[model samples]
Target: METTHGAEHVHVGRDGWLFLTAGSNNVVGQFSRSRLMARRVRGWRRLVVARVRGCERLGCRYLHVIVPEKLTVYDHKLSAGLRVKVRLSPALRLRRALFWHRSARRACLDLVGAFRAVRDARDLYFRTDSHWSFAGCDTAYRLICAACGAVPKDLSGEPQEWRQMAGDLGSKLTPPQSERWPIRGLQRDAVRVHASPIVELRERTGRADKLHVGAHVIYRNDAAGTDPRRVVLFGDSYAHFAPIMLTALIAETFAEVHFVWSSSLDWGYVERVRPDLVIGQVAERFMFELPDDRFDLKAYAAERFGTELAEAEAKSARKPGKNSDKSPGKKPGKAGTSVAGP
Candidate 1:
């Protein structure tokens, strides 16, 4: 029952497991039985209902997934000194609030229960990282596909390799700890067809975290056995637009998938894409701020990177014998890297 304080925000638990107890989101505070949390639960219920109705009008199926924090799923690994109840999780609270809604059954995925059911079999999340491992991501992926009535692809057979790296939580320690995480060698059939200007600029500058609010990318799968539906996913780092995470799994399952790196939904983009399915994924800790669904990703990107983009374009134009018709920056070589928050 011993708990040792490692970094400023990390709660060092038994067996090298690190849990995030404090940070910008106040991870531990979220489990409190307060009036504020009650109101937030109601707000989330309304938001989910609104999303469901909106998607219905567009003849699109919708699913809202809240990726539970490691503390919620693996609290047993935490020290006895840490007083937090997994039942008080905001995700569970929101689910309870939405229980009366008619769309509840179809609009939300029960990840908390799913994770708890099989957590003891293996490590679903990284020991020292805040993000989930391939096993955890795959679990969610299967649930998503099942909810969408799509056949889930079995990536377990994919080639795998191990690599040691310091995760977000581990890096916060005085002497950073590293773990050998399993890297899935996925033979991805989906190819990146498009990336927004901001993504391109950030990639070129090696600052993928800059102006990341509106980063967007599209993947198209021409492989056999893929679902013949289009999907638009508005999510954070958990469902990243990379071959190694949830986005790639969805893309491999569907014919086309658009990944927007934002928690807020852009209805206009949804209307334009006219996807057959719309998915919104958010981390449980970010339930504090409710999104207004007024996010214009393009405008946000323009506002943030307009000056830099203009400078790059102008600089390129000044070069003699250079093709000005080409895009201002070179195509991004790899997917943008994301570090999970505490």
Candidate 2:
């Protein structure tokens, strides 16, 4: 993790890169490709210039700043479902192609398991909007419980209900261009997931990794006492689930669990935390964001693994098979010399 100018750090993963942005500026690339395309292309340039020129003509220089402010407030009011509806369709074909790629398919399986875990626990997702479907979250929650050796709660015995709570996240994404994708408001009914009280071992502090939180704040019962166990989690939304899910699962295994993300874990954090097991998880399409110049995944992994596993794999690959002449106990025979060769 590279510390930025503002005491903030950038997180890179084994197969991922860290793209650092300026202060208080959100990393918008976490969305679908259409959103990224719209923000980075010439189309966005024209849109911005036009707005700036319009503001100049009105002699309201601050209007340039006000436009973004207005849009951000507008987006904050909308739900990710509405935002995704508008944001994903334009890139549907691209996303579909990505979803079919071998790597992408593998990624989805990892995520699907995570989703399944959440659902099996009778907790789908937030009732107001954003994040995974309550159904999707159930899948993730279950996978984690199993992985951590925790006894999973049965969905059949848990009854889920929903109540509308006022949320401000949807209105926060104000894209500059009107030619952009469709955006919408948060849903009126969201799933209210209920589970055992999370034991928050570490008090929730603002200093604790913000990148790990992303759009959702996870809570756990930390009162279980402290014992250090190693955990490696990867992905955007997928990685975020690890902290909350494992806090539950770890209770069954290690007394304390160290949570790290592929997206945000820097070499520094790895060196400092020194977790025993590392997990890498993410959505299928996230690979597109892997080429940031700011982070070194190779160095990070090298530090984390300490060159042992790499050397072990190389050694194992060189061992001779039973049929190979190079086998220590087997002697080489001529083509027709063997008893069965004739």
Candidate 3:
């Protein structure tokens, strides 16, 4: 049991490398290239389509960013036992899912390959945490800007350095294992904070981590950057590494930036923000249940507009010779369900 990180889901590998158990059913098979689960991939594709159509209807550009799994970037570190379990690859499964939807295919971009190109030159992800290192976040920022068509100032010369700290995962461990490790992070001077970041709303209760009531703020230099546009970005903890940093670097490019911590899409908020670009991102392991898949949009709509919607549905149900509108208020906002996350 000590070999596992949490819930027997993480496998301790060589040189302190930690890999996630591939399929939930086979937690013991760490780094196993097991067969692709076509059904789950299909479900993810469907959700992507829904999100794309919904974003299009809102006149927003949609871009899906997928965080690379640790093993994906560091497969070489896998133990021989798990490494030889070769059967199927999740990366390929994800690619198959990507090709299933031409729309998502074209828009969705995974950074594992990109990271590989420069990984030897610099570390892109944390050695322990599921999140990326600041260097990785910087790379993602560049990619996101390119996707959003936001030209940023040359920061290659920007000062950067490595900081030693206990990451989220390492902190969970005890004893000598909890020792601080070096993580490539941005220099304080690199991130310029012209103004204080705002807190739009804090979910009063829920998981402490997800309770981070994020806000959308633009950071720009009056002397540079493209014209103002609008963007609504959503994601899991991975967003902490990319979008939030991206927001600081290219916020000026966007006329408005709405960054939601929740993986679920707040369509009502999307409508309210009316962003020109919409981005949803998540760590690769969590891709099994995409944010949109976990979220119940129908229920969210009812909860947000319940009273009037229920009234309207009841009126329609009573209409002579009309089908019953039994779906709307069957249960009071049960659809405002949870958006599960790590």
Candidate maximizing TM-score: 1
Candidate models: Cα lDDT each:
0.83, 0.31, 0.54
| Tens-place lDDT digits, model 1, residues 1-342 | 232364768888888898888878888998989888888888888889989999999989889999999989998898768868889999988888787886865678999999999999978899989988888989999999888789998887744777898888888886787799777755378777777776777777787755446778887787888898989999988887657788888988998888998888999889888999999999999997788798887787778778988898888888998888887754543343211100
Q: Give the TM-score of candidate 2.
A: 0.33
lDDT of 3 by residue, 287-326 (tens): 5544543444335433654574456567768888876835
Model 2 error, position 267 (Å): 3.8
Prediction 2 global C-alpha lDDT: 0.31
Ranking by TM-score: 1, 3, 2
List the candidates' TM-scores in order: 0.91, 0.33, 0.66
Poorest stretch of ten by lDDT in candidate 1: 333-342
Candidates 1 and 3, the one with greater TM-score: 1
Q: Residue-wise lDDT of candidate 2 within 271-298, one digit each (tens)?
A: 4434443333433233334322223444
Sorting all predicted structures by lDDT, with the top scorer first, yields 1, 3, 2
